[model samples]
Target: MEIIARRIATEFPKTNQAVGVNIVSLVNALAGQVRIGLLIFLGVVTIVLLIACTNVANLMLARYAARQKEMALRTALGAGRLRLMQQLLAESTLVALAGGAIGLLLASWGTQVLVALLAKNFQIPRIENTHADGWVLGFTLALSLATGIIFGVVPALAAASPDLNQSLREASRTAIAGPGGWRLRNTLVVAETALALVLLAGAGLLLKGLLVMRTTAPGFGTENVLTVDFSLPRRLATLPGTPSMNTAIVMTDRVRFFDALLDRARSVPGVRSAALVADLPLGGGQDSLGFQILGRQPPPPR
Candidate 1:
């Protein structure tokens, strides 16, 4: 990006103006004005994934606690701690893979719904072309494996080192989780709660902002207003083997076209007025023309 910016600056230097360039991913470029909002949503999704992993870790801890005696018996017989941890991690990986599969399916459907809802509101180029492919599948597989290994570690470690004497006692149905186990579980719960609360707070703020915007006035009556946008072709239409019209004639034709269009629109019933503007009010873009005052030096750029 820096290289591109430097090249643009060197090639397109302007007096009192900086010429720069920004490099973005195709997805970010397509998102355009809503790119920041999309990034915030991506962060929220990451937090949700972390909370899910924490919850899964807590569940694994509980499961291990229930089967403490079984693990102790296996250890007493001949099972190695490394072997036990491997078995637990394998189980967690399988579970994660299954969940990831389900999530992928739902995500495909959700993408279609999201594109349909937002297409009219935003200028997202080629949004409909978005779909799950090999890359998405590969990412899902990698993420699932990583999540499984990370969340499964503490529970697997705790379960692999059970108190043999306590677990072997006939009266003890469930093995007691030591301070470390308690701390790990508590910490996961706390982290999960914190993430959830943060998500809720962000959602509340977004909803409140929307409500405020809904109530706010735009200082103009928007009713019965119909705006249309179009572009003029660079070259005027010409018969085959005929020369194209010059710039002056082309500009004259464009003016006449607009005059005819406005005249036709005004002729329609219930049409109170018609006017032309370079850009619509409250449009997402602005058009500007630079000018200098006569007999006055232009101010320096800030």
Candidate 2:
């Protein structure tokens, strides 16, 4: 491809030194910044998930601390350490699954709201078709189970091996937790706070960027403007004195068709004007066509 580009550039001898070709993946060319933005949002979502998990872990720790006497009593009554851990993990898994169900429901409703909101502002492809399908359900289920086990492990381990004598001797329900338990809880709270701050900072930056974009003008009047997109048929039927393979004739027909379409649009009631363009302003994507400068000889035909 580079060699071909160099050969093509040589045809424009005066501009050969200035001309260069860059190869970009089609996905990158089409999705561009939108893809980057989605990735950033995904990272933010992951951070938020971590914050939520940290908070839940702290709560689980507190719950286990409160139940230290029960755990010790169970252990004294022939309950193995594995049994106690399993019980705690079961409770955590149940909580996580419940939360996941609720989140899934909210996400379903929220997706509709988001699609409607973004449709008016941005031109994201196939956004309207967004839905929680089988893959989404599978992912949610996996995430719920993983989150339950991962976040539950620390508190479960801390609670499963309680001091049998001290916990049983302490008659008060408000007995202080062990240093290990306190340390773990404090660590979780600190982590939760830090993650929250990071999320806030990221959100603030994104909001500021969005506000700046909204305020910035795109060198065109946008009010009262409407855009319609259409495509011409790729294959035309062969007719008398007309070659279906002629590219120039096909483009001419397409141009005339657009002109007529615009004329009809202008004639409609309450219509002030209409015009045609290859791409709309602030459309987030563009199509490029080949053209030569005036007074320059055209390149040889392939």
Task: Name the top lDDT candidate.
Answer: 1
| Model 2 clashing residue pairs (backbone) | none
Off by over 4 Å in 1: 1-32, 170-173, 223-278, 289-302
Per-model CA lDDT versus the true structure: 0.84, 0.84
lDDT of 2 by residue, 1-302 (tens): 77877897787666574567789988887678689989998999999999999999988888787888999899999999999899999999999999999999999889889999988677777778888888888899999999999999998999898888889999655333667767887899899999999999988988899999999998989888777776655453333256436767766776687788889999999889888776666564457568998999999654
Q: What is the TM-score of candidate 1?
A: 0.73
Candidate 2 runs further than 4 Å off: 15-17, 214-302
TM-score of each: 0.73, 0.74
Give candidate 1's error at residue 232 in angstroms: 9.8
* Shift in Å, residue 8, candidate 2: 0.5
Error of 2 at 3 (Å): 1.0
lDDT of 1 by residue, 1-302 (tens): 67777776666566323755557888666666677877898999999999999999999998888888999999999999999999999999999999999999999899889888877666677776778889999999999999999999888999999888888884454474678778888998999999999999999999999999888898898889888776665454442344555666776787798899899989999999998888666775567668999999999763
| Root-mean-square deviation (CA) per prediction | 5.7, 5.4
